[model samples]
Each structure stands twice: as C-alpha cells, then as structure tokens.
Target: MPVDKTSYLLVDGENIDATLGNSILGRRPHPDERPRWDRLLAFTQERWAQPAKGLFFLNASTGLPMAFVQALRALGYVPVPLSGSAEDKVVDIAIQRTLEALGERDDDVMLVSHDGDFLEAITPLMDGQRRVGLIAFEEFRNSGFHDLVRQGMEFFDLEHDTRVFNAPLPRLRIIPIEEFDPQQFL
Candidate 1:
C-alpha cells in the first residue's frame, strides 16, 4: 500500500539498548524494565494525532532474536532485520538510509535513538513541511538535537514525555520549576 502522508516511527533498537545500559541504568535492563513497544506506538498516535507505522531496525549478523522479533510483529511493527560483516553497524546504516529516503517522501518521522550519527540525515528533514521528531531519553539524547529543536524539530523524552513505559524508570533529570509537580515525588 502507498503510504502517503503516513507517519513513520523508525526505531533503532541497538542505540536505545546501549544508551539505556551505559548511560541510564549503568547495567543491563531486565525484560520488564524495557519500554513497552505497544504503548510506544499508542503514544505516538495520540501525540501526533495521526496513525503511525512502526519500522523497527535490528542487526541480525550474529542471529535473529526470534522472540523479540515476533513480539514486535505481534504489536504491529515491521521488524527490519539486516545482516552484514561483523564490523558493520547494520542497523544504524540502514536507518540512516531510511531517514534519507524519508526526506523525499511526504511522511512524518519520529526516530527512536540517542545516536548522533543520524544528525546529518535528520537535519534537512526538519524543515516545517513535515513533522520530524526525535524520541529518546532526554538526558542521553545526542547534543546535536538541541540545534534541531531550535530549527523546529520536536524532541520527546521516551519515558517522561511519551509515558511509554509500564514501570517508572530510574531516571534523574533536572525538572523545570514550573513543570515540576510535587505529587510525582509524593
């Protein structure tokens, strides 16, 4: 089917996992600690006020994580499994190309990652013509995204902004005075 004016939710599973482990948690997350993929799709639809199509990219050079892939499929996401040489960053390269291609299409995109490698592809697409958003943990997002925010690209905190997780994560971010509600801590 022709996906005209469709919102594309491109997920970089590798980047998300790395950042979650290295930056956010400082350890590997348990199965239940991970973001719920279904809620992510639901959140994007409500936030964008448009139906979204999820495209989850994963590197399959070693082998496919069949359970995870099947889970994503059950939730309506297309698992884009790519494989290449051991040295290749298969997922990042594929998503970069996908982002570049989306630049020519009229689709709105919300990319899930904290990797800075995508900045080049994300820049040109930030023009006001279509909605371009970055979804990542706020404190861990690539610094380059600040410039994109100034250029009108929307940035959404995966947990805080999207409320896409089933359980609250152990994240410590500076809460702006006005936006801070005591009830959260209470």
Candidate 2:
C-alpha cells in the first residue's frame, strides 16, 4: 500500500548503531567510521514515499564527535541531544515525549529502534487516525515487542536490504594525537 501521509522519522541513534554494528559489521567501528547517513536517509525517504523529517536522538554525555554531528546535519537530520542519565532514561524519555506531542498531528510516525521501551509511548498513538511503523534490524525479530506487529504496526526489516544501510568497513587509520587531522579523516 502506498503511504500517503508525511512521516516523522524518530531514530534511536545509539540503539540502531549498536544493532547495525553487531549484525552487519560484526563489531562496532568507531563512530567516525559508521553508517553513511546520506544513504540511510535516502532509503528511508523512498520507503515512506515522502520526505521524512528525520530526528536522530543521541546521548549528550557520550560526546558525539563533531564531524559526525556535522554529517548528520548535512544529510538533513535534526540531532536531538539529550542528557545521559541512567536514573532518568533520558533518551527514551525524550523520544516518548516527542512521540506524544506528534501523536496529535496528522502525519505518520516511524520509530527506528528495537528497544521495546517505546511500546508504552507508541501504544496510544496506534488509534486509526495515523499510521505508525517500525524500522528495525531483522536480528531483533524475536524481541519481546512482536505484539506491536499484531497491533497493526508495519515493520521494515533492515537486514532484507543490507546494501543500503550497512556501511562498508572503514580503513584503519592509526595516527598520533599530534598528527591527527580531522580534514584528512573525512
């Protein structure tokens, strides 16, 4: 079926990164050598049949590399940096709040994360007024959230098309801190 509504793509950056690293790369590479943001965004836009407003959630205390942040911006994704407080569940809470706020809108919502913590926030939005879906790694197919599928949420498996989402392993670059040059890295 053709998707006719605008999609708000909320990406759980850390969660997706870990999944892709383990499933595709076999090991997590440095953030600098990770997924090609531009390609991923294009793929999502095509899947939804509309230009999605991408919101990538990142933990503030983890400290994202400046280059990675710039690349995300260049690819048109808004980075929502939140505090990393285990006691508060900062990232998840921020995402839930955004989902709640967007629930009143007419557009569809697509969450890119396998963490089932979102179920609580997503359940209420499944009301028939707007479409809600998930973009998750197939490796997590058995994740306790399968109930979401039965609830009418569409699931897009990233593993089915690894070429688009899996970035090629980056060449090893070993250099001294004094010799490190950010320009040459990109």
Candidate 3:
C-alpha cells in the first residue's frame, strides 16, 4: 500500500541555537526569543499545501535535555536525539543520512538551518523534481545556499517569512522595497 506523501520539515537545532547565541543575540536567547515550533510546522503545511512531518535534530551526547525534548514533542516535533563521541558532529551526520534516504521518497523537504555542511546532501535533491526549501535568516545563511535560489530552491526568512518567534530578531537583512516601512525609523 502506498503511504501519504507528507512534507518533511527537518530542523538543525544545534546550528540554530549556536547562530542565535553567538551571532544574532550575542548571548543565549531567553525562552521568549526562541522560535515557536508550531508556527514553523504551520508554515510548512501551508507553503507546500500538504501535511508536514516536523523532525528536530539535536545532539544528545551530553545527555538529552528532557524539558526541551518534551516541549518539542508537545509542539508536534519528532525529536531525533543523536549521541556520539566528543569529536563527532552527530546531529549533522544524522541529518545528512536522513536527507540521503529521503531521495527515495516523493516527499518535499524543508531544512531549517544556516550551516553549509548540508550543501552536498541537499544539492542533488534539487534535481528539478521534488520541492526543496531552506528556512534561515538570509543574512546568516551560507553563500552556497544563495546560489541554490537560481536552481529553483525556495529560500525563506525564518523570522520575517514564517513569523515563528514571539520577539523580533536582530537581523541585518535587506528588506524588499514592498516590505519597507519608513515609519519605524521615526
């Protein structure tokens, strides 16, 4: 029997947290500054016009953060806790393998990350067939991904496009003329 084709929403939790803390916020984010995972799922479903299966990948080598994992589960995310030696990039490896496996399925994929490590994994997936999207703050995204836009890869701003966070993010991105509002400066 054929199963339903659901959009796969893959999240790189570590990359996002690191980028937010080190680059965007200049420190660890408060609870309110975190993206609302529910909104991301909703955006994926609506954008692709299909049910989205949200998978959040995290490094669990140091032990699982049960509270965060439980919260993710409550918000409809499947927490993929991966463990490995101190030198291993466990989460990235797991996500890459998952992406490779997805090649056999007809499901659309939306990857939430700014890391360039997945470039090789996602490059072949955009063979002018299955829909693939990247969710990240534009200014922080890898320049390699910016090239993918020409190859029909859909790029979205996590904060502006998805409106996933309760609090505004400090992103220095060029706004499209249509979205420019001068009143904020006054």
Candidate 4:
C-alpha cells in the first residue's frame, strides 16, 4: 500500500530545548530555566504547524516540571505521558507506535530532533516511502544523523528560519531569534 500522503510531525521536547537554549544562552542552562520552556513550546508550535500535522511528545514519567508541560499544551501540542527508559526511548517508542498504527496511511513523518539515537527508529519509516524530516538546529551538524536528513527529508534549523517569527506573530514573542529569551518570562 502507498504510504498515506498526509504529514505527521513528531517533536522531541528535550532535543528542542537542547538546541534552542544553546543558541539563546550561548550554552546549556544551569539551575532552573522555566521561562525558556514557554518560548520553546511556542516556537515548536509555530514552526511545525507549517505542515499542519504536529504532534509533540514529552516523557511524563520523568517528572517534567508541570508548568512546562502545561505551556506546551497551551501552545497546541498533544502531550502523551511516557513511562519507561530515557526520554529518547520514550520519544522513539511513541514515533514507532504512531507509524505502526497508521501503517500505509502515513505519508510523511517529521521529527524535531538531532539525536542519532532516533535514526534507527526512523529507518523503517523511510524504507516504506514515508518522507522523514528533521527540525534540528545548525550546531548539531557533527552528528552522523545528517546523512539521513540529506537523504529522506528536509532539515529545518530553528535559528536559520525566521519565518516562525515572520507570520502575523504569536500572542507571545517566541521567535525572531534575538528577542526569544525565555528567562524573563519565567
């Protein structure tokens, strides 16, 4: 059966935070960074919404800060409560489940992560004519995962594309790169 032509986006919350925060703070944050959580969720929603099939995943069993999860939901993401392994494993499992359940009905799968660990999770989907894409930041170019990105689907950089900020604009300022500091809000 031909893969479904519809697009489906899978977001890795931790991946997004790692890349985006690095760009904003010049380094990974220390201590609590609650405000950045809001900005990240908003940015993900606006950027992934382009394909109109965004589904964000969070590792609920990890005891993620409650406020951040709520912020993600507020930004239009469907948060699933994950309970096992690392967050990467949780995300990979969720992606696999989605592909299996959809079967031939899924045409494209967009994953927002640069972690090489997910490459295996996405291989089957790519083999089946399912277009798999990545929404990762430029700093993560060292990973071999770039091979998959170059082969199967588009690779969008959060900092490179200002379109997320170019639209009518979100009620909150989550994009534009420069003004996207989440620390002030928290």
TM per prediction: 0.94, 0.75, 0.96, 0.61
TM-score of 4: 0.61
Q: Relative to the true structure, how large is the alpha-carbon lDDT of every model?
A: 0.90, 0.74, 0.91, 0.59
TM-score of 3: 0.96
Give the range where candidate 2 is weakest over 10 consecutive residues by summed lDDT.
162-171
The clash count of every prediction, one per candidate, is 0, 0, 0, 3
**Model 1 regions lying over 4 Å from their true place:** 1-4, 183-186
lDDT score, residue 166, model 2? 50
- For residues 1-186, write the lDDT of model 2, one tens digit per residue: 854667788888778787657755678766555556666677667776787888988888767667767878988999887776668777888999998898777788888788888888888888988778887765564465588788788887654442443544432434569978899759
Worst ten in a row by lDDT for model 4 = 165-174
lDDT of 4 by residue, 74-157 (tens): 765667667785535776678667766555565666666667766665666766455566766656643776676567556776
Give the clashing pairs for model 2.
none
lDDT of 1 by residue, 24-105 (tens): 7899988887888888888788888888999999999989999999999999899999999988898989999999999888
- lDDT by residue (tens digit), candidate 3, 1-186: 966778999999888888888999999988888889899999999999889999999999989999999999999999999999999999999989999999988888999999999999998899876899999988899999988988899999888899999878777778789988999657
lDDT order of candidates, best first?
A: 3, 1, 2, 4
